[model samples]
Target chain A: MSTMTMAKALNAGLRRALDANPKVLLFGEDIGKLGGVFRITEGLQKDFGEERVIDAPLAESGIIGTSFGMAMRGYRPVIEIQFDGFVYPGFDQIVSQVAKFHNRTNGRSSVPMVVRIPYGGGIGAIEHHSESPEAYFVHTAGLKVVTCSNPNDAYWMIQQAVASDDPVIFLEPKRRYHDKGEVVHESKPIALHQARIVRGGTDATLIAYGPMVKTCVEAATIAEEEGRSLEVIDLRSLSPIDMVTLTHSVRRTRRAVVVHEDVRTLGVGAEVAARLGEELFYLMESPVLRVTGHDLPYPNSRVESDFLPDVDRILDAVDRSLAY
Target chain B: MSQPLQPWGGPPGATPHADAMTASDEMVQLLTPEGRRVEHPDFAFTGDDAEIAGLLREMVLARRLDLEGTSLQRQGELGLWPPLLGQEAAQIGSGRAVRDADMVFPTYREHGVAMLRGVPVGDMLALFRGTSMGDWDIDEHRFGQYQIIIGAQTLHATGYAMALQRDGLIGNPEPDRNAAVLVYHGDGASSQGDVNESYVFAASFQAPVVFFCMNNQWAISEPSTRQSRIPLYQRAWGYGFPGVRVDGNDVLAVKAVTDWAMERARQGQGPAFIEAFTYRMGAHTTSDDPTKYRLSEETEAWRRKDPIERVKTYLLDAGAIDDGWLSDLDAEADALGEHIRSTCRQLDSESLAHRFDVLFREPTAESEDDRDAHLSYLARFEPLSEESAR
Candidate 1:
């Protein structure tokens, strides 16, 4: 086991995927010589050469469309969208082409493409740089959405996503890129599209994913000190939404709080809350509460703290639910 | 009948000057507007009368399919139809250029090209009929799913071409081992960001792709002139590839250029662009009204340059097929149309219930739940089929 940051873990995963298959291609803006803005693709171009690791033109739609084409031709192309907000230009290709290609072709053709976008509002950046666009992707049908909270998940999930036949929207928690953690690289990685219970408890379940998972875990520990045993569920997959694990946690706790940086309205949190209400209606001590960003344009980084949900916000939701 | 007798792309009220042919990279034409064979300096139609007749025959069949599709839409049998009324030769010529191994990525209106790609007339109408996008399983066909979004497939084709390049399919010692990609778009789509980006990537990577832009006078309601200040083909020069403007109405000219271009790509010469200068002789689709946006005089002018009409005229002029033969071909085309009508009618109305079936290679737990929920909801109504309830 090596102590590595999420960035290094992802880099290692990309290396392994490249080493595993010659047909696997890497394409994005500044991914080649620059090794991606986050350097997650560092040393890959140098190792794999220019053909395998491509520095594509600065066009999101082109990156996706071409990747979809490459996938059609039996090549697995992993594309980087550079940033969360930048993916909008290629959203049409993602929703219209990448997602639907498999369904339209009756599962005969699949876009085995991975789109990695560094997401969420932290690291004190500009408007477009810091934004949570995962909600939009989770809404799309033909794609799978996943995120990594720590180094191990980052290392393992990147490899799993690349190897997947379905198109995957890999949302990187840009804020936690430097957070160090122990990574265990095994012969086989953990199952994708399944949620893992990071912490177990019976009072209430704190559900979150990607950037919010770390935050929720911290919130659970703080909640423990407050005399409430909180279960923290790190939802790795958003689309299929590891509901089996989520239901187990919610059923045990009988109360839940969904937390995320995405806007509260029709967000991932809202979907979780809706599902819980449907499944655990009689067992619930209270309605599923949500602690999320306000429904407004992601503000400039100076005021981002005011917009982002934090430990205090999670505790407040926990308090509100316990009162019920 | 086409006002002032001036062919398009020239000065108003003037036939394309004889100097026009010699002026630029002369558009290679094997058949002229007058139905006479012409000799070109660079390209020639090497096909025998039988093969040439096949081209004409396919064009007629495609045109008949298009007419039947339009008629079907008018009679409420279809929701919409994007008629390829004038761009038959451009599609057929380029469609024929690709080998069985080579792939095609075409924009939505390439009905002729789709027909050549092994999708039948009725299967193609499945899109217009609101049954499915296209009836043929897109995975099984050499052609891609008909992309409605303009200029998007150009990049996809280039991506596929890039793969072809990396696979060492291009420049293979064995001719049959080599393969390339041909993508179709239009003048208006040239202005799209995706189309331009596709060019950049294809040129940068030296992808074996041919961008066949049917500059069919109008892009829906907007004119081609509004889309490009200079001739469209020259735009390829800016992207670092050889580009040509071919006679879209001249089947031989299109086939020759496309063939040469695809061969050039397989030889690792990078991508090639061809602007098939034609006209939209009919409305863009069943929903569009040409009278609102264009003049009838202009339509009359384009009708004179009709691709199928010119091919028929050429065949008759060469005594390739007599009136009796032409009539027999028409009878066959009508029979095909009848088959399409019957096939469209026979398609199960509730086929959309199987929407969840093709969603994934294997159904995910969530998708399975969704399917169950949907089926349960449908069962609340009188179960259309006894098996649908479970």
Candidate 2:
């Protein structure tokens, strides 16, 4: 097991995918020489050559639209949207073409491609840079949405998403790129669509994904000092939700709090809360609560920390759930 | 071959027909609207009598199928139908130009092309009849599903061309080893962002793709003039590729032009564009009304350049087919029409479970649970008698 940052882990994972398949191609703006804005694909162009690691023109729709054609022609293309906000230009291709290729062709052709988007807020960056656009993709059927919080998952999930036959919207937590964690390359650690229980507790269940997973885990740690047991579950896959693992945790804890960096209305948290309510209606001690960003637009970076859900906000939600 | 560029924005050039009938030097023609054999400096109709007769048969059968589709829609058998009425030559000529190894990405109205690619007439109508969303085996037929979105298939064709290049299927020494991609769209689709981006990508990558745009004078209610300030083929020049306009009603010209473009792509000469200048004699679809927008005089002018009649006229004058052969083809068209009408009626809508089954290659836990839940929900009610259900 080697300790590395999420960015390095992702780079290593992408390199592994390229090495595993000759048909695997990496295409994006500035991904070739500049190695992406975050340097997540650094040294990949040099190692894989310009053919495999291609620097595409500054057109997101063209990148995805062509990638769909290549996928139809039996090539697995891994595309990178420079930022979460920039993905909108290619939104039509993603929602219309990539998402529907498999179903549209009646299972004859499936686009085994991956769209990598660096998402979420808290780095105090510019507008459109720090945004959580996972809900839009998660809401889209035929698309599998997943995000990684730590380095280990970043490594394994990147490879897994590429290996998946279905198109995957792979969200990377830009804020957590510097966070280091041990990645065991020999082991998979977990399934691509399953959620993992980061902390075991009995007082309340804290459900989160991507950047919020770290905040929820931290909340559990702080709650432990105050004689409160809060379980933290990392919802690795947003589309599938991994309800089996979530239901088990909620049934045992009897109280739940969902956390996300996305807006409170019609967000990933709402889907989790609704499902938990329907499935675990009799088992809950209190109504499911959410500790998430406000419905307003992602505020300026100066006050983003206030807008973002932190350890204090998560603990507050847990306290409210325990009180019920 | 090289005629003076027809001055744009002129007083209709004294021709009652729209833009394509101006007899410009830029446009290539093998056979004129008067059924007179014309020679082009660059391209010629190299096919013999048998090939010409075969192309004429295909155009006739396609026209018959299109009329049957319109009749069915009028009879409430179909939700809608996009008739390929006047664009028969453009479709058959370009569709036949595509070799067996090549791939084709067609817009929704390419029923004639779809039939030529070996897809049944009934299968194409199934999309309009609401029984299927095009479940044909793409790899087998080398044809993509009928793309309903305007010009999105251009990008797909470009990408597929790039894939062909990567697969070592282009610029091959052996003839059969080489492959290219053909994408069909219309004049209205030429203005789309995706189509323009496709040109950029295809040029930058030197992808082997032939962009066949049938400039049928109208995009529903809007005229082609609204879509472009110049000839549609000229758009390819700005993208660093060869572009040519052809007399769309002349089947010989379309076939020759498409053949030249496809061969260029197969030789890895980069992407090219061909504007099949024709007219949409019918409405864009059963839903549209051309009378609200276009002039009767313009439609009447184009009627003289009917794609089918010109071919029949040329073949009969050339002594390639007699009255007996024409009657036999009419009987064959009748049989095909009956087959399409019966098959469209028999096309069944697949079950919900089947839809869920095809959504993902590997079934997810959520989809499985949802399918099971739906099944149990239906199972709650007692099964009605099959006779009553029917």
Candidate 3:
């Protein structure tokens, strides 16, 4: 195991995927020489050559659309959409074509493609730069949407996403890209759509994903000082959400609070709450609560902290749920 | 009035069709707008009168289907409909020209092509209804799903063509039986990066594909003037292939062109780019109001060159059908319209619930759990009985 930032872990994961699969090709804007704006694809183009690590034109839709054709031609294309907000330009290709190609061909053709997007807010970026658009892809069927909170999961999840048979929307938490964690270099490969229990407890369950996963873990640590035991489940997959893990945790804790960096309205938390209420109705001490970002565009850098949920907000929700 | 604007890259005295109709060209338009048949001498249409009538009937049906779809949109049964009102000649002609084995990649507005491929009209409406993604199997129909993203289909068609050729499927060396792909886009799509990249890949690999661009004058509110400064058809010559412009409203001309192109492709010749000069009689979609940007005079001028009306006029002039037969055809069209209206209504309630099933062929364990939870929650209103559960 090695301690590394989320960016380095992702770089290592991509290197492992490229070394494992000869067919894996990386294509995106500025991903070649610049190693991407975030440097997540650092040193890939130099090692893999231009053919495999293509620096595509600045068209997001073209990158994804052509990658679909490439995947059909027996190439496993791992595309980077650059940013969460920019993914909309390729929304038509991602939703209409990439997602439906399997069922449209009656399973004769499958898109073994991965679209990596850096999502969520808190970096205080410009307009359309810091947005959580996972709900759009998650709502659309035929897409497998997943996200990683820390370096270890980011490293393994990207490789798992690339290996999946169905098209996977791998959303990286841009805000958490530099956060450090111990990453196991080689581990038993996990399923792409399953949730992992980052920290186990007994008082209540704090479910989160992407950037909020770390926040939830921090909230759990703070809650320990306040004599509240909170379990944190990192929901790795957003689309095919791991309800089994969620329900089991809720059953054990008898209370749950879902958290995310996206707007509270119709966020992934809603689905989690609705599902928990139905499956584990008798196993609850209180109504399922959520500590999420306000339903507004990510505010300016000065007020961004007020818009995003932090350790205090998450712990407050836990206290409320425990009091009930 | 002004030297006919000399196409894109033609010679000083070159006729529009002269430079376009090369033997190696995939865009071999045979008929000129003056209703004159000009063959390539090397390639000819050998079909008899009966075959011509069948082709005309297909075009007529395609027009009827398009009209029916537009009407369905007006009735609020569809989320949107990109009307193929004036491009029937281009779609029908090219659709009929392709062999059964050849694959076709279509943009959103290829209703005529879908009809030719035998996709049920109800299935096509499902896309607009937002009830289903696409209803037909791409392999079985040999027609790709309607791609809403502009110019993306060109790459798919190119890749498929490459696969077919690489497999040595070009049977019988005497009259090469290689499969070809026809990818349809619009003049507006010509400005897209993917379309140009598709041209590069097709040229580089010598893929057996045809890039069919229907230059229908307008893309929503933007005119062809904004899309290109020159005729889009002639742009193909720079890409190492011939490009032709045909009066897309003329069904005969479009059929002649597409047929010749498909034959060249089957004979192992490379890709072709065709520019079908047509007009859009309606708005870009149901939400669009054409009156906001377009002039009434322009619409009226294009109406005179209506694809269906021109074919109807020529059929009557050639004594191909009498007034009674025309009336019977109108009645058939009316029946199709009625069927579409009723089918659309029936689909509203039935198609709304299948959104989950189409999400994944094999739903992940989590998705299965989600669906189960949703069903149980909905069951509270009317609990499921043993029979209902089964």
**Top TM-score: which candidate number?**
2
- Which residue pairs clash in candidate 1? none
lDDT of each: 0.86, 0.89, 0.80
Return the TM-scores of chain A for each candidate in numbered order: 0.98, 0.99, 0.97
Clashing pairs in 2: B3-B25
Expressed as tens digits, the lDDT of each residue in B8-45 for candidate 1 is 34344543323232124556677887777788877787
Model 1 chain A worst lDDT run, 10 consecutive residues: A101-110
**Which 10 consecutive positions of candidate 3 chain B have the poorest summed lDDT?**
B18-27
DockQ of 2: 0.80
Q: Candidate 1, after superposition: displacement of residue B64 in Å?
A: 1.2
- The DockQ-derived docking category for candidate 3 is incorrect
DockQ score for model 3: 0.21
Scoring each candidate complex against the real one, what DockQ results? 0.66, 0.80, 0.21
Of the two candidates 1 and 3, the one with more favorable DockQ, higher being better, is: 1
State TM-scores per candidate.
Answer: 0.93, 0.95, 0.72
RMSD versus native structure for model 3:
6.8
